[model samples]
Target chain A: MTSFFIYKAILVVVVFGIMLMAAMYSTYLERKVAAFIQDRVGPNRAGPFGILQPLADGIKMFMKEEIIPEVANKTLFIVGPCIAMLTAIMAGVVIPWGGELVINGVPYVLQIIDFDFGLLYVFGVVSLGVYGIMIGGWASNNKFSLFGAIRASAQMISYEIAMGLSIIALIMMTGTLSLREIVEFQAGGTGSTWNFWNVVYQPLGFLLFLVCAFAECNRTPFDLPESETELVGGYHTEYSSMKLGFYLFAEYINMFISSAVISTLYFGGTNFPFMNDLGLSQNAITILGTLAFFIKIGFFVFFYMWIRWTLPRFRYDQLMYLGWRVLIPLAIANVAITGLVMILTDRI
Target chain B: MKSLTGRAKVLDNPKMTFKERIYLPAIIGGITITLRHLFKRKATIRYPEEKRTFSPVWRGMHVLKRDDNGAERCTACGLCAVACPAEAITMTAAERKPGEEKLYREEKYAATYEINMLRCIFCGLCEEACPKEAIFLTDRLVSTDYARDGFIYGKDKLVEPVDKRVDVSKRQTPNVLEFKKIKHYRHNR
Candidate 1:
């Protein structure tokens, strides 16, 4: 029992380390991406291609000053980014990185805890993500920040419905909410023949899921809360130094989580084709599969950075309109169509 | 920017109707557009190793000419210094002695010619005003650096080597009198 606990602890630590590194690098990458799209040289002096820029940025943030608004909620002001960071990291816990690892003859799945309701658990965790922004904006004691918070909350809630509904269609098709089962199903076939992959069979679901995923994560076009010209700094208007860093770091963490979920649902999670047929050992296959999954995930993450740099943000009313009128209806119709098709095909 | 709330809400309103509110059709349409651009030949040029071609007439950085015999062309006539609207050009006059005839073309020559590049508007008036045809804006890329002081162009910094012109005739000297006469001829006619 103790050893099981220890194993879980180790998994948590490793995932935490990945999230931390990815978050730090993501910020540096965002700047580099922006520069690249505009045909300008970004930070290259700090390190090779400005690799050490994250460290420099961290140091700068830490050394700088912190302030509290006189009329603002002091506890919540500090709590805002903390909650944002906490909730962001918390979303990663249920996500499985590798399939399984047997250390000293003790076999275990390389996840912190594989909850039965894994899909819902992710949705639940992400839903709470809004609280961080809401609290931060409210605590800011600025009317602009409050307005941003309201818009953000409304956007998130509306997108969450579409996101949740899209997953229902996937869940119905798969017949299980468990992420591990989804991976196991995909493992048996060769690359393109893998019917287990969600992107192939449920392409409309994947499309709706991808769009909702962007909105849920508060990415560009949907990034109205912190719109520089409009809300100033948005929820973190009054935040500075490490506090601000926490908020930015949380955003990357949210991105990593969302990317992982997308991979798990539509791209077959950590599963690759006919690994046992390839004659690789179980451990080797598991490691290979894990690596393959991350490669796909990394591409999606890069895609986000690329898209973020290339696109312009949306207006507030436009954003809300897109979320409610557009995404929700399509997601519902998609769910209905998939359900009807599955019943007719007897794949259900 | 908050568009002026009262007026902008009405004038610039892309009002969402029944179908417009449903974002998927619009998003799909938009994604189709972006995907085309993504696959299309990108207009972006990876700088440093690969550079975009500049025009032959592109007046980038300035250079002070030396004669075919390697003589300083300026007489420190202060015509360029006086005509510069930006007051970027500065020079001090020095007299050439009998022994240093090879060094300078005229009796009075520029002792120190410096341009505060930060102040230079690059209006080409200095090129217009030079009687000796010494200063010319050529197509040259400048090295970018951090400091504000690095931007200032000294006499040494602005000077380019009198190399064999690949495009222009190698034997031709930049004749200030000839150029001035051409300008005078144009003006007179």
Candidate 2:
């Protein structure tokens, strides 16, 4: 039990470190991707190919003068970013990094927790993410901040419904709420056993979930909350120094977590095709699987940036229309179709 | 109204079709376009490390010229000062002593010549007005400075060094060279 506790503690630290590092680098990658799409070179001066740009940006953020509005609620202003960073990190707890690792005849799980309601835990944490923006925006005592916060809350709420409904279809197919079991269900490669990824079973659900994920992350085309053109920095308008940094960092971390969840839920988390046919050792397979999982997450993160640069932000009315009318109905139809197909095939 | 250039596009407000409304195909097309650009050659020159080459006839910073014996060619005739539309040029004339013949090509020389670079429009009027081919605009850019005084370029900043010469051969067109050979021009004679 003591060893198990030690293992869990170490895994927690490692995972937390990876999440922070991934978020840090994502900012650099975002600029690079944007520059490339526009036929420009970006930030190659800081370090070779601007690899150290994130560190410089972090230092600059920290060195900036801290400011609090005279009319602002100081306590909530401080708690806002704290909550954002906290909830953003919290969602990563349920993500299954890879399969189990056996060290010295003792098997250790790569996940922080394998709770039966792992999917629900992620959903719950993500829903709570809005409170951070809301509290911060409201406390600022600025109209723009309030507007951003309201939009964020409404967007998250609207998308969460469709996001949840889309997942219901996947959950029905897998018959498991635990992410680990969901991954395990799709274990074998495309061979004799033929356990395909969940995407093959829930293509429309995956698409709906993807759209919802973009909205939930407040990414572009769905990024009306912090629309710089309209809101003037939006929820973090009143924030300065590391406080503002925390808000931006939280967004990137949320992006990283969203990408992870998308990969785990639909793209077969750590499962790779022809994985079993390789006849690799359990430890080797686990390490390679972990690597494979990270690569998939990386691709999704890049995809997010690609879409961000390609599409313009949706109008507030357009956003609501798409979320409530288009996505919700599509997600419901997907769930119904999935149920009917499962019943006919006797998958239930 | 009829289009002047005959290239005007007609405006329309047709409702979106099912395919357009879905937006998946358009999104994919945009993604493909950006992907192609990602692999295309970057348009950036990465300035400081790389600079674009200027045209040979590009008029930039002014340089005071010298004769073959390295004597100052200007006789302080003041034609350039008169020709400068921006009133950027100023000079003081001084009589060249007998022993100073090696330094000054003419009996009279510009003792204190100055050009206010901030006021000069780089119109190459000074080059056009210099009868003795004493001043020409070179292909070197005037660097930025912090002080207003720094832009008042004196002889120390403008004059070509004895060891090295400013080449203005490109600016001397065939017509100017042919006119110089006419021998009737007092400076040419």
RMSD to truth, every model = 6.5, 2.1
Q: lDDT, candidate 1, residue A348?
A: 65
- What's the DockQ for every one of the candidates? 0.12, 0.84
Residue A159 lDDT (model 2): 97
Off by over 4 Å in 1: A35-43, A185-187, A190-195, A334-348, B1-177, B180-189
Which candidate number has the best DockQ? Answer: 2
A130-186: candidate 2 lDDT, tens digit per residue: 999999999999999999999999999999999999999998888889999999888
Position A240, candidate 2: lDDT: 96
Report the TM-score measured on chain A for model 2: 0.99
Among incorrect, acceptable, medium and high, the docking class of model 2 is high
Each candidate structure's TM-score, on Cα atoms with residue i matched to residue i, is: 0.77, 0.96
Scored against the true structure, residue A322 in model 1 reaches a CA lDDT of 71
